[model samples]
Target: MTASTTRRTAATKSRIVAVGAIAVAGTMLLTGCGDQTNDGEAKETKAAAAPLADKLPQAIRDKGVIKVGSDIAYAPMEFMDANNQPAGVDIDLGKELGKVLGVEFKFENATFDQLVLGMNSGRHDIVMSSMTDTKERQQGASKDATGGADFVNYFKAGSAILTQKGNPKGIKNLDDLCGLTVAAQRGTANEDLLKTQQKKCGAKKIKEFISDQDSDSITQLQTKRADAVITDFPVALYNELEGGGGKLFEVVGDQIDAAPYGIAVSKKNPELRDAIKAAVQKIIDGGTYGEVLKKWKAESGAIETATVNAGK
Candidate 1:
């Protein structure tokens, strides 16, 4: 079967929030980690510091904290919980990374579009948001170039289509998006993909919103201003489960352009990059990695190893 076909099956079996009993079952499958307190499930026993901690930049070692820039609105990856504290798979990973590096992980919540700029400007040490590792981003070819941030891939994800719970428009895939209004976060690969597919879909209307927030796009769909929202697969799935209790929206298509999500560090900080990569692998081997993903109901996206600059 083709990748799309495989994705379709996966969506049907594991991710999509269908209507009626099927929707309840799909939501139940992932509810394992949803109700825990923000810090509850992510609180894993700390592992010994990895040797790479010694390789960290002196300034960082002295500071004893790795400042992370993230748009904390993507649920289950990085977002605020009931107590208004940052919590999610990425947040838990960052905490584990801190343990391995022998330092605290300090998150600096910023607009998604500002993350790269923040790193380049020295406002943040690393970005652990569920940022995709793409060729264009890794190359820093965009107008917002900050000397090309390097990435240490840690998870797998892809673009998926989300529509009203019942899929009123009969949307199935990109082919079905023709002439329809689609919403996606601005500056994200999802938006870029839609722009590229516009012509192929007979000039579909694409609406872009600030990357820091996904609610805007969801609002567009809910208000009938957009026929669908295209975003990271996990984000859409999580929203369907928690945002409206599986009643507001449903994933309609197979994931497309599957890619790795990476922890971004400035290219100037190769030492930090290598240190983080090693720390990540250490956690994966120590079992803490799986704990974090499982806590977020995102074990499906877990990676066995971490690779730097693996974008393609």
Candidate 2:
């Protein structure tokens, strides 16, 4: 959903094409992504020389590439830049981590809701979407709702409400949406928050206009289909600043549900999880993490240390 679901068709195709190129290079250069056959000696030698090569599982070590599933729509996290290339905090951090692991962190576009499920199904080696590390996800509460995986928490953020500029509805908080329509990305924490708010709305229950991506929700708000949109604080701020060249939207009220954003890794791949944890800590220590957040103006969500499933 990079650039939003409306942009999903073109952007996703661009990423797939970009990824296909990378995949092909991984094959041509690394001889089938480190096939391990005698013909792959050139790739093995180069890959084995990486700084953190010893930390990865032998199978992945040979591949020299980590398949990443990401929505790629949330700006400042993962998004396609004007150049139509993948760029953002998550993308930058993944690049640094890739250097340490001696593997190309090849991101593939997917709907935010499908990232974890796809990862669990073996479509990806990991998921680098801005996914929260909730307890239910750790225990695999639902096959599609939250993938069963270990989370390597890197950043923390809270959800916020985004309303159209000029305060048209005089909305200040969640309660204001009691009888209004709201938009949120399907399968996100924001969607859940809205549902919880609905119960309190009583007779004037909140009407929902859920979309596949946040941008679409923003579009709904722009078109007056929704009174407001709920999303991550950083995302709300980003849209408020960039949307309409900083004139289209504005953030209202305080944020809620502050929690760590984790990179999803299979529980079965403890080695990969631990390796990523270490790699992130190294990136933080090395100052690359700070640089990335600074570039995205997202230092507010920066975490002091990388941990596992630190979200409550």
For every model shown, the clashing-pair count is: 0, 2
User: Which portions of model 1 show Cα errors greater than 4 Å?
Assistant: 1-52, 203-212
Work out the TM-score per prediction: 0.80, 0.84
CA lDDT scores, all candidates in order: 0.80, 0.86
Cα lDDT tens digits, model 2, 159-262, are 99999897689988889999999999888888889999999998998889888888799889888888899999999988898888999899999988899999
Which candidate has the top score in TM-score? 2
Write down the TM-score for model 2. 0.84
lDDT of 1 by residue, 95-123 (tens): 88888787789988988877888898989
**Best candidate (score: lDDT):** 2
